[model samples]
Target: MQDTTDFEVWIEDNEPDGYEEIYTLYRSVAEREDNGIWAVTTNGDKTFVTGPTSTLQLLSEKARRTFLNAVEALKSDPEMDMESWYGYERNMANSKA
Candidate 1:
């Protein structure tokens, strides 16, 4: 696995908006079946299974970056809402089909 600290720095620099980019990256990572199960957790401690990963290490790095970015964005934007973030993620998933 890549150093999560490095991934954190990358995410901090990227500062992705909403959940679209992260969600899409996660879905792509999850589609690979050889890796272990991928999961995500929210600040509220809610957890969800993302999928089976073909590249567990890589996906772990991606997840760490994504989650870090999400947390940062949420903190930066006080008005940011989780419902909207989830809705955006769903829409991105739908569009991928």
Candidate 2:
């Protein structure tokens, strides 16, 4: 597994109709009984998934590119603010709700 020191941007399909989308930054963390990915949305919603790798692979190409760019920026600047930097413009559409 890759080192998960930084949070990763992730995307999930909200429904079969493809009308809704959920975007998040996730980190692998340990829980009392098990380990999982802790996902936090721009809207401040929190969720969890058992397998981080699978969930990461599910992201769309555009989302994947955004995530990679964010990661690269973080590598250059350790103090970068993820919330503001990661999905700024993309989340504008989501923020309306």
Question: For model 2, where is the 10-residue window of minimal lDDT?
Answer: 14-23
Give the runs in model 1 whose Cα sits over 4 Å from its true position: 1-5, 32-97
RMSD of each: 9.6, 12.3
In model 2, the runs with Cα more than 4 Å from the true position are 1-58, 77-97
Give TM per candidate: 0.29, 0.23
Task: Give a tens-digit lDDT track for model 1, residues 1-97.
Answer: 2223344454444443445554444443334322223443333322233333221123454554465454435432346454456565576669664
- For residue 16, model 2's alpha carbon misses the true position, in angstroms, by 33
Point out the worst 10-residue segment of candidate 1 by lDDT.
47-56
